[model samples]
Target: MDSRTMIASLPCLALVIVTLGYLGLCVVSPFGRCRACHATGRTRSRLGRIRRDCRHCAGTGLRLRVGRHVINHLHDEYEAAKR
Candidate 1:
């Protein structure tokens, strides 16, 4: 294929891959980066000498992905009922 065709298709190819990855994450981990700390779970001072916990996930390095919270909520309710 020519360079022009390759360049034109690059975006579509990327979109497909991104969509597949997102779907896989939704089906699997159901976790997303902690926006508070940008997924680092902690941040360093400007001097890089000090770091702190992510307050959100409490430095767990992971957070529940969007739309999955309700699923967890429902599961919790079901478990409570079972017990």
Candidate 2:
């Protein structure tokens, strides 16, 4: 309504929008490229000679997004509580 009120609410509105966008992203694509090896599943030595499998993603080149991981943990907790 008033300018002051609208300005105060702007941060909340922006946060909600960003949260919803992240949730949608997590739902649509739960797995993201591994950060360690950049989805190549292998990393090279500092000299770029020897290559080794990525330990972070176990060489799968994919990792659970943080949001998706949190969602899954919450779901597991809810199921346990329900039981």
Candidate 3:
């Protein structure tokens, strides 16, 4: 393939790799609270309150990162929507 064609393909390949990596992390990571009761597993009451374990990590849980930029964007969207 020509250099132009090869260069054009790089971004697509990178995007595919990044998407796959994110999916793999979702499959493997355990860092969030229980969904049923929104509680971490350390406390007995919270654990008891959960009728069913989380599907993501089989009750191990996952902590989703909410970055400042994402929060700001969400806030902006919310404010705009309210208008």
TM per prediction: 0.49, 0.89, 0.39
Ranking by TM-score: 2, 1, 3
- Per-residue alpha-carbon lDDT of candidate 1 for residues 1-83, written as tens digits (9 for 90 to 100): 99999999999999999977876677688888888888888977679899988778889878887647766787899999999
lDDT of 3 by residue, 1-83 (tens): 99999999999999999977765555455244556435533333455673565554455554453333355577799999999
lDDT, candidate 2, at 24? 91
lDDT of each: 0.83, 0.94, 0.59
- The alpha-carbon lDDT assigned to residue 66 of candidate 1 equals 65
Off by over 4 Å in 3: 30-83
What stretches of model 2 exceed 4 Å from their correct place? 45-48
Q: Enumerate clash totals for all models, in the order shown.
A: 0, 0, 6
Candidate 1 TM-score over all chains jointly: 0.49
Per-residue accuracy of model 2 over 1-83 as CA lDDT, tens digit each: 99999999999999999999998999999999999999999998788999988889988999999999888999999999998
Ranking by lDDT: 2, 1, 3
**lDDT for residue 10 in candidate 3, whole number 0-100:** 100
Candidate 1 wrongly placed segments (more than 4 Å): 1-25, 44-50, 79-83
Candidate 2, residue 13: lDDT: 100
In candidate 1, the residue pairs with backbone N, CA or C atoms under 3 Å apart (3 or more residues apart, or in different chains) clash, namely none
TM-score, prediction 2: 0.89
